[model samples]
Target: MFDSLAEKLQATLSDVRSRGTLTEDDVNAAMREIRLALLEADVNFKVVKRFTNAVKERALGSDVIGQLNPGQQVVKIVNDELAELMGGESAELRFSSSPPTVILMAGLQGSGKTTATAKLARLLREQNRSSVAVAACDVYRPAAVEQLITVGARAGADVYERGTDADPVEIAKWARERAEREGKDVLIVDTAGRLHVDENLMKELAEIKRVTNPTNVLLVVDAMTGQDAVNVAEQFAEVVQFDGVVMSKLDGDARGGAALSVKSVTGKPILFASTGEKLDQFERFHPDRMAQRILGMGDVMTLIEKAESQFDETQAKELERKIRKSEFGLDDFLDQLRQVRRLGPLQSLLGMMPGLGGHQLRNLRVDEREFDRIQAIILSMTAEERRNPDIIKGSRRIRIARGSGTNVQAVKALIRQFGQMQRLMKSMQSGKMPDIGALMRQAR
Candidate 1:
């Protein structure tokens, strides 16, 4: 979503970093470029101005102007200011000392409030090891209760609903009581939302808050709405209190203005981001890491965290042993591939690698179906053929290709690539660096 903005900012920073010296004009030029980039990204005008001023002030300060590497200092200043503008650090969800921490979810009707509720419930259950229950207090929209019932179950959280017949406030109150009785670790109240921020919406939300006395009130904002999302958050801040923000639809084609400007406009930190449609794609937002990504510096920590979540330590050790023994068969390869795919889309994962952010990432197109095709080819192979690829003669290869819905050439290419990979692994196991250029030539 930040692709356009990221490209412009990264280009500006690249120019700044190429210089050996610095001038006030240079800093001003960079700030102007940044201001334009943010404006083009639909950022709040006031936020853009404030952010640029901060970056410019620091870039012109004595700490940077006469520094040994002034340009690098300026880049650092921009990165720091950007992080500060979003939120200096990641915000943690406040849990009650008592059982059943209540989290009140508020947002506009189309802001993905109900979906965010389920996603947040799943996140808390996994990360906090909490037994979560979600209250279906959104009785206004058609099928709201049923929607919660379906998604809430998928999230592995108990759904508390009195159906659309019950008052939202009463449902919230009862949910709190039930969660307490059941000794649940958390209870997320999914409240009703309006097409816009209106009096009825605020009043109902206030009533729900009054009844539930939630530990944390989270306002869900659609990142796709850009500046309008920031405006809605500001309006909510004036009438009702919310602890933090959840920026949803973060993977959309929106300019990312909402996620960048909400904290600055409303003084509420973004606690979570819904990056994809899947419930598991939701994650805690880290401002510093986001800032680095925007600046074309890869987020290695987030990459590692995602990898650690998907890869099993014991399985990793076994896989290593298999590679060392030249026993890494196609079955093992398929297992490893499945695990990597579980870490999210291959393109997004590559974007987290060092030196592949910004323009480089924009140009890369990862065909996910290639994974499916590879899996199909591997699955078509018999157990003996998978274990011993040398026995896959011309006729065998033809049969496998036919079974896998591919041509014979595709099958042969895959086998050749696997052979090259095995040779590379053998070299690594023997305490020698593989000849990558030679291996690539062999695969071709």
Candidate 2:
């Protein structure tokens, strides 16, 4: 997820921010470092040149050169330019006024187009509450249709796939009609892709577009392909008029090239990003938030949004009540842990926190196995022990350890941590701040 680029940029910015005032030479030096970072990240050379020039012009302007905390001003300018370069604002999928808004999905073979189709369907269904139905028109690929069916079902979208024999155009047209007749809110047509951009691919896509008259035409590009993905998007732009891009494999160690360059190169914003393999991992791309994340400024808005989506009001209120009454036990803790796990990887969540981005995030190895061990240890405990951990003694500790396949020390550490958390909660409930220094001493 732009780890290399983020590290280099954050390091360069860290140095810039340390300076009290920035001279022309200082700005040039920082810009040179940034140029190198972007180039190394495989960003388009033209885009890199344009972006650097813009940042330099802004940094050298009168507003920043002699200003208080000039270095901070320079960093702000870079963040702004980076966000602007990545399409300033997030793009939204257009829906038709009529029923069954048609969305045509296009891409080259192995671009994760099929998977992205299902992911987008799931997102629209969950976020927009749309009755989504995905049409499997990728007949050329062997298992493309079946794959769409499997993933689409998991996404809770109706699959309107006419197996591999039917013409993709006909399937798309038929699927749209069916969706309209069935009163579906959306119909996503997943078109066939080729090994390379060929006449047949464009021709078939054009025919499908003509038939479906989609409200949106989304090009799914593999973000991990770096410059090649941008090139592919450029080619697609030349042949078909896509409304936006769906960047797949964004969770991979993508050098941050395609995601940064696609909008600039193809004149299309990336509407969605497929961050992981799971259908639910897809999310709308927000250029500002991404720029902030890359710059080591946490994206709290996105973090909060994730929490809101996973934890409903009733559950949150119940948890708060339990905490206030000192009734939050191992079972409540387990449930909370599971809810957080659903938000995504812990490392990713941490990366969204301010001061924990880039190198800091890379340095922290958040062992997901620890979570598994915690779950196992809690499950191994009796209901009574979970309700009141204080009841466990010497013999009970050893038995619980063996049952959980863990060591006594591990169980002890977990209980200690939980106790500290409870103490902190109790302090808050009593309208007093806990003694953090004392707690640190106790933990040690």
Candidate 3:
């Protein structure tokens, strides 16, 4: 998600890791490059200065300067400082002792506030919050209430809307009463957003706050806005005073200045991030894991979490059994492919694995469209052909290609790749990949 910044920072850290020992001058030079990298990534100047100074002070301290692995020590210091700069630990939503803890969503009009409200509801559903209800208080924007209802429905949360004609504050109060009467555990108020923070906007938000008595007020910030987002958060804090930030569109080409600077600049933690447009693509922010990913170390914990959430244990076990027995067919393969697709973008998945540098990722040129193509090809085949791909010769390949609206060569290539994958699966029975030379030959 921190694509540009991660690229620059990973390259800088990779050099440090390659060096056996580091002199003070060496560290200073690296720090200068790091400073420039952060600045180029659009990180705040003040935040960058403070972050570099902290890293330098720790790197030059007794523990690291005389250490046997001084370079590694300095890298560790940077990772720690990066984590500290972006909120040391994850901040979760705090619920009230009373039932129906209210969460008020606030942000600029184009910052993806309503969508984030639905994403939050979806996350709460995963957290065992079944009795969640969303109230649409955004009366200003055209079809704003309808937008919230649609997304809220996708998130599996009941949406309360009194139409766009009703006053937003009364809509909020009415929804609160409805959720309380219905014994809901949580109520999220999607407040209206303005083009910019103004007295009128703040006044309406303040009135909603007074009526709803929200336990948590979350400002959805577009991470792609960079410095302007930090400024918006500061303005909101001065007026409405939100409890945390929900940084949306992390999957975009965001330089990541706001995420690093928001909490430090506005005294509010970033509670969650929306990595993709999917309703289920929301996640709680983890500074340490993000720092690891930024340094090209990968984030296996998040990978595992995605797997746990998307993969069905029974189905996964059956698929594993089929692979072990060499019974994995196009049907099983299609099922597995769909499951992997549920885990979000393929490039993002690969980036989470250890040692996959940004350069390698870029070089891979992994096409997400490949999944759709494979699915189409597999679906075009008959039951027998799918069960036993070996029998699919020239005529069958042509037929499948036409059915899938693809060329014969495309179908042939897919079959060839599938055969290679099956062979690799069979060889993995020994818990190790086949010899590199043999594997390369098979790949060819």
Candidate 4:
């Protein structure tokens, strides 16, 4: 997630912000450090040069030098230039006028093309489209068709696959026809990938394109490849003439050069970013939010949007009422946990909040085993016990703990923590809570 680059940039900005007034030399020194950081992050040389120049010009402009908070002004300039370095705005998927908008997925081997196909289908499903089908045209790899079928099934989409003997182009044509007959609104063609850019791959993809008449040709680039990703995108664009780019593996230790330089280098906007292996790990690329992330400022708007998308309003309101009344029981806590899980991993969601990035939540690993333990404990509770915890005497607590495969003390500690959290929420709602800083200290 560009952790190294983010650290470097945050340190550089902190130094600049510490200075009450910034002279030309101070700005130059800061820009020099930023240039080094970008280069160390493996950014393209041309992009680095252009970015440094734009940032320097903006920092030295009268608007910044004359501002009351020159440090904030300089950070603002860098953020703006960073956003511009990526696409200035998030790009939309281009749909054709006809039914079955064909989308061709292209990438090198191991770029997660097959998985990205299902992620895209899930994304389209969220848009209220029906009957999204994926066509597996990768006949070279023996298990490629089955792999896509498994992913498509996980995404709740139909998958069309032909055996290795079938020509990929023919499979694509047939898949599209089947989608149309089945009344599918979109058909994604997962084409073959090469170990390296080759003429054979390009020729096959071109034939598939000709047969399917794809509305959008998306090039999936691995963000971990850094500047090499830019070169790959350029080569694919030349051959496939793709409409947009999909940057995958962004949740890994990607230096982020690909995301910043791909669109600028290839003249194609980034349509989506694949953050993880999960089917719901895809997000539309947002230039502004990405700018905030690069600058160590979290993406609050994107975080809120994700919450809104996954949260059931009625359940949320009910929980809110319980919290206000100090009646937040284990059932409500479990419900809240499920809602948060839908928004993605706990650490990732927390990292999107302001001042909560960096190593703030590093020690709190949200592993599946921990979630299972919590669920087991909750399930061990009787219906009456969950509704009214005060009725659970020591014997009942021990019994529940034994049922959940946990010790008695662990069960007692969870009950205490839940009670504290409920009381804290009630106090906050009533405007009687202490400052968050003090509460955090007490929690620690």
lDDT: worst 10-residue window of model 4? 431-440
**Model 3: CA > 4 A from native:** 64-68, 299-444
lDDT (Cα atoms) of all candidates against the true structure: 0.82, 0.82, 0.79, 0.78
Q: After superposition, how far is residue 372 of candidate 2 from its true place, in Å?
A: 35
lDDT (Cα, tens digit) per residue for candidate 3, span 1-444? 677788887788767755655778888888999999888878889999999999988888846321124555676778888889889988888898886889999999889888888988988888865678999998887788889889999999999998889999899889888988998889999988888899998999999998888999999999989899999999999988789999998888457888888888898999999888889888999988778878765543344456546554566566667878988888877876676667676665543332333344444655677677778988999999998999999899889989988888778777777787788788664322112222122223
Check candidate 2 and list the clashing pairs. none
Candidate 2 C-alpha lDDT tens digits along 144-210: 8889989999999999988999988889889989999999999999888888999999999999999
Error of 4 at 309 (Å): 26
What ordering of candidates by lDDT runs from best to worst?
Answer: 1, 2, 3, 4
Give the per-residue lDDT of model 4 (tens digit) for 94-147: 887778888899999999899899999988988766569999999999999889
TM-score (all chains, Cα) for each model: 0.68, 0.68, 0.67, 0.67
How do all the candidates rank in terms of TM-score, highest first?
2, 1, 3, 4
lDDT of 4 at 43: 87
Error of 2 at 353 (Å): 20
Candidate 4: stretches off by over 4 Å: 64-68, 299-444
Query: Worst ten-residue run, lDDT, model 2?
Result: 431-440
Please identify model 2 stretches exceeding 4 Å from their true place: 64-68, 299-444
Q: Write the per-residue lDDT of candidate 1 for residues 1-444, one digit (tens) a residue.
A: 699999999899877765666789998999999999999999899999999988888888746321124665677778888899889989999989998899999999878889999999999889889999999998877699999999999999999999888888899999999999999999999988888899998999999999999999999999988888999999999999999999999999457799999999999999999988899989899998888888876543344456646455566567667888998878887876676667676665554332233244455566677777888988999999999988998899999999999878778877887787787787564322122223223323
lDDT of 2 at 68: 23
